[model samples]
Target: MLKTMHRPFHVSPWHLTLACGLFKLLLAAAAFALPLSQVDDLPRLVGLLLLAGGFSELLLSWTGRHSWVGRITFGSGALTVVLGALFIGGPWKGLYPLGPFVTVWFLLRALLSIDVAFQSRLTPMANWIWLLLRGFVDLALGLLLLAGAPLAMLAIVVFGEVREFVTLFSATLAVSFAIAGGGLVAIALTQRHYHRSDPFMIAS
Candidate 1:
């Protein structure tokens, strides 16, 4: 009397990726919605929020598409997670946190642009130049933050140094979250379509 074994359900990568993307977007919303700025330990509170965002990013990386695109995505996510951990442990407080956070965001975004480029290649006559250009720009921004000179100048021009550059940093985070979230969802949909068409493609 042999018993049949039941296999546990496995989540599709696209599903998990979209969920993580949505969660990341929500983290940005939470960061903005909460009035933690007025509190005494802004760094600790903000650090916690960033930690949550980082965790989602790590999860996204884990569930992202399986390819070189995914590898770069994972590296980007891991780097941001490390920065969040550093912020929580000590240092990376106040204005110092902004640079690393923004830089990491741009770097992650650049990797995502690579993913977009990879996807575009599958389409006919795809204008991958746009995606590559965006990736270059994002990479430049991250490098500039490391340079410290240009980022400061850009920050001053965009949001000014007043009010601790809070507006500037938050805006950066917001844009990163928004773009990544939307892109991940769109990519997930595309992947789903591809999966659905696989059998037909094979038969053809």
Candidate 2:
């Protein structure tokens, strides 16, 4: 007689969804709290954040063996880090505008996310919706930054309190990154759990 074994219950998709939702909400709230005048710095801040995020993501992807996420995430992170480094390291070139670069990055990220959504198993419709929304936000923010309208208005409203604006902006960005990083780590842990499961059982 063959023996059957039971697998341990792992974190469900719903849990991941909730965690991602909370992380996004925190990021949104942080953005809202940023002073209007500091908006111009968004591009630089985003570049720095991307650099850090990309490195972390690469580490996670390389260490985990779940499906396409590891490879895709690793590739995406490496690209982001390289591009971000170039943008920040290079001298200011009018043609290489932060807005356009950010826009392209977001679009690419969104398209890549389609793979993430379908990998391993089919992602829920709601997850696809979330990815689309994130893409939209990235596109909109990039456009806004390029147009220079919001930043101008913010500067006028704040009357040029440059130091305070910079400080607040930096703080908000730090918080956003913290939340995002934490969420990614959590999801990675969950994936590791699943990957480590026994090959004989579905939960494994």
Candidate 3:
């Protein structure tokens, strides 16, 4: 089992930042590729994904913590799950824009990942590179979301004419949920691997 501590291998914050950025980029790509219409539907999908990813992190935290790095990872993962659940529950009526919220979430995750990467002391060079790429992608996506608000609105208006567009939008949302759910499941499996090194721990 991982024991929580104040320090581990003397990893850096930039690594964690990179990891966080990469995760965000992956999420943005997954979301952007969908045929989603309104931003409201995004939270449900994102929340589900977070729930899965957090579960994984929780497991990793339990197993890898012989140091401060473990503590941070577990804490962050727990927080993510909690926040994700709140988002999934749909607290208010259109309280937040799905697009912006998702974009911000990804950006934050990317930052967190960078921190993780630096602190963990695990290296392959590729991991760091991946994280950097992810961060840049997430940042770009966030900027696009911010800049494309009017354009998104315009798309909504343009698609208001045909039922096919609405149908496609609904299908897109359904696919998003599936993909997010799958991602969560994958994360959970990863956590299980870290926890017991058992291939079967991921059956859920």
Candidate 4:
């Protein structure tokens, strides 16, 4: 019987989720710690954050490749990666407007969070409610940026207080990322508990 028995090692998917969550938290901390003197580097920071998030999404898509969730995750990840590359590659001062770029970023992120929340409902994942709330928070932040971006740009142009605008933008991104990271960490911990109780339970 011992010769016939086999045990295969299986790494839990939540491990990746946990790592990604912790990474995002670190990113959030970095963003929050940015000083006013380094405001000029905000674009690069944003680009890096986008790249990190995009890669995480791409990896996550593998967990559900045959489902609609996977398709959306892949698409979102691709777009985010492209946008992040663009932001990092060029100065973008004369190429395009920052308002629209930021608006789209926030919107895409919001949609992804909302999609994840809905998908979580189909799984044994805990903290689906928190994911839903996080989605709404992302949505609200995106909408607020969409509505106020033009006004903010106008103010920047009139007053030439570019630093102030960058400051506010950085702060907003920091808070959003922090919330998202925290939510992920919480969900990952809960999923770990569930997994321990039942080895069959998996979180995607």
Candidate 5:
């Protein structure tokens, strides 16, 4: 009975994957829920998404904190939470403040994704190639955002509207979130299936 109870307490990589997937889905929903026309809401939307992600990571880290990865995740979560709060409370307005901020965020996550995809090659993680592809997509999205920032500013100077720029960022985020969320969920399910079939085949 004690061993049976203890078994459930053991944390696995799939748990982290699932949590991240769910968080990303939440981001997608939030991004879609906010009308892109209300450009003022962009920063707030990003803040909420970051807060959700930070809390998810923090909770998962608490469960798996004996490992080095967990410690790193905890630190990241704390920093993310801080940043999220700042974004929410700050007096930022328009693309001038948000474009560069989100661009940097996407680029950092892209690098992390690519690194993790490579690391997973040593493990039996499912759809690792998809992960690699997602990383590339993220990288591309980040680059696009970076390039679009100046163009967006120019649009404001010429056309007096930044709707195209806003739409581009919003659409990119929604699509990226959906793709990453779906892939991570699939990978988690595959890992779960493999674990059931061979209890000792994969390490937690």
Candidate 6:
């Protein structure tokens, strides 16, 4: 006799994990496959990937339903959507614009992943180390973007003279996505519980 005005939505944690995993893999693939030869196309491709991440984050927001984490994710997802569009704009060409955005986006999600991975301390996940590793990697990338990248990278992003730098960035991006994505997929495949559920309201 579950009677309520609002229908409750039940969500599968594994499903969310799967969706996210697939998305991360796709992003990685796109990053690796992008036509780096054509510098003009890099911004657009990067924008598209960012948009994908935003969309995926939006979808994943449901997993956090009714929780602070969910609310934060929802907000960040919205911002990502806008930023993705901005990146796609022709004015924001080159790595300069995308670098900062990517850094922030990765850092935000990295912390989230680390926070959730802590659940393993109590729940004990066999592959929990991977999650921690992912977080550390993400943190490193963000820090690099903030300061680790050579100061001249800004000039390189603008002039496109240092093809090597761009190559390195793309490579790093691809690796990050691969590892993070794989972790998500593994988490989903192994998860055995439903995080939440939506039930139809029975009018009594």
lDDT winner between 4 and 6, please give it.
6
Number of clashes in every candidate structure? Answer: 0, 0, 21, 0, 0, 8
Q: lDDT (CA) for every model shown?
A: 0.57, 0.48, 0.48, 0.65, 0.66, 0.67
TM-score of each: 0.64, 0.50, 0.49, 0.77, 0.76, 0.72
Worst 10 residues of 6 by lDDT: 192-201
**Candidate 3 lDDT, tens digit per residue, 1-204?**
543333332222333323443454465455444345354555566566668657755665565465564576677677668767876886633323454565565457556556755543342221334334444554554565567556665665676324343343334333333333343334444433344221111111
lDDT-sorted candidate list, best first: 6, 5, 4, 1, 3, 2
Q: Of the pair 1 and 3, which is ahead by TM-score? A: 1
Which residue runs does candidate 4 get wrong by more than 4 Å?
A: 1-12, 35-37, 94-96, 196-204
Q: Given candidate 2, what's the lDDT at residue 161?
A: 35
Query: What stretches of model 5 exceed 4 Å from their correct place?
Result: 1-20, 68-83, 196-204
Better model by lDDT, 3 or 5? 5
Residue 42 CA displacement from its true place in model 2, Å: 6.3
**Taking the tens digit of each residue's C-alpha lDDT, what string does model 5 give over 177-199?**
77777776877787676663112
Residue clash pairs of candidate 1: none
In Å, residue 167's CA in model 3 sits off its true spot by 13
| Clash count, predicted structure 6 | 8
Ranking 1 against 2 by TM-score, winner: 1
Q: Positional deviation of 108 in candidate 3, in angstroms?
A: 1.5
Q: Ranking under TM-score, best-scoring first?
A: 4, 5, 6, 1, 2, 3
The better candidate by lDDT, 1 or 4, is: 4
Give the number of the best model, judged by TM-score: 4
Residue-level lDDT tens digits of model 1 in 12-33: 3656756876876787676564
Which consecutive 10 residues in model 4 have the weakest lDDT in total? 1-10
**For candidate 6, lDDT tens digit of each residue in 1-204?**
644544222233667768788988989987887645577777777778778877887787766567544565566567667767877875865666567777887788678667655644333222467677887888887777778466646667576636666676677677777887887686566563333332223455
Worst 10 residues of 1 by lDDT: 195-204
Error of 5 at 14 (Å): 4.6
Q: Which residue ranges in model 6 land beyond 4 Å of their true spot?
A: 1-13, 35-37, 72-76, 124-128, 154-161, 192-204
